[model samples]
Target: ILDYFELTKVDKEGKMLNIYLQEKNIAPDGHQHQDLESKGFFPEVEIQDFPIRGQKVALCIKRRRWTIKKTGEIISRDWGLIRKGARMTTEFGLFLKGIFG
Candidate 1:
């Protein structure tokens, strides 16, 4: 997909692209910690495609964020770009299944 993205426009390294992923996490609502619950929120995936463009390089995922909420617990899951440039593609759908399962 990077190759495809490159076709349209070069995404230089360190150029931050903000991605919003619907994450289920327990965020303090400032109400109470006594009764904690899992709430869905859009967690940002902040990362840069590395190596910098104009230098002719592959799309390198520099950084990303992922979180899972389990009331008194949090877990980090694996993330990968199943598709690039295109939003919510079939590959992205499969990636969700992999994450959920």
Candidate 2:
């Protein structure tokens, strides 16, 4: 899960911590093909994470894009880090549910 993203930056706003991460540039099929071209990044997404030292943490993920030279098809990695219908990570969501469910 952590291998898919690279830590880009970290910012602290008052009691909140913002972590910026950029998805690694690799083929969506999990292969490093020579025909792949680097494209722009997708819109940034924010997901809440477990707090640290009583400070809320937010993950700002930037998903990269690529175009296949052979087919001209744009593709990107589908990282299912966030749980369905929730803005927090799957691990964090499960932790909260276990404590309060």
Best by TM-score: 2
What is the per-residue lDDT of model 1 for residues 1-101, given as tens digits with 9 covering 90 to 100? 43222222334445443332343332333423444444333343333322233342343322222233334553233345535554344454566669898
**In candidate 2, what residue range of length 10 has the lowest lDDT sum?**
25-34
Assess candidate 1 and give its TM-score to the true structure: 0.21
List lDDT for all candidates, in order. Answer: 0.37, 0.88
Among residues 3 or more apart in sequence or in different chains, the pairs in candidate 1 whose N, CA or C atoms overlap within 3 Å are 13-52
Instruction: Evaluate residue 99 in candidate 1 and report its C-alpha lDDT on the 0 to 100 scale.
Output: 85
Candidate 2 regions with alpha-carbon error over 4 angstroms: none
Candidate 2's displacement at residue 24, Å, is 1.5
Superposed model 1: Cα runs more than 4 Å off: 1-6, 13-87
Candidate 2 lDDT over 1-101, as tens digits, reads 56777998999999999999988765676547548987989999999999999999999999889888888888777777899999999999999999999
Native-referenced Cα lDDT, model 1? 0.37
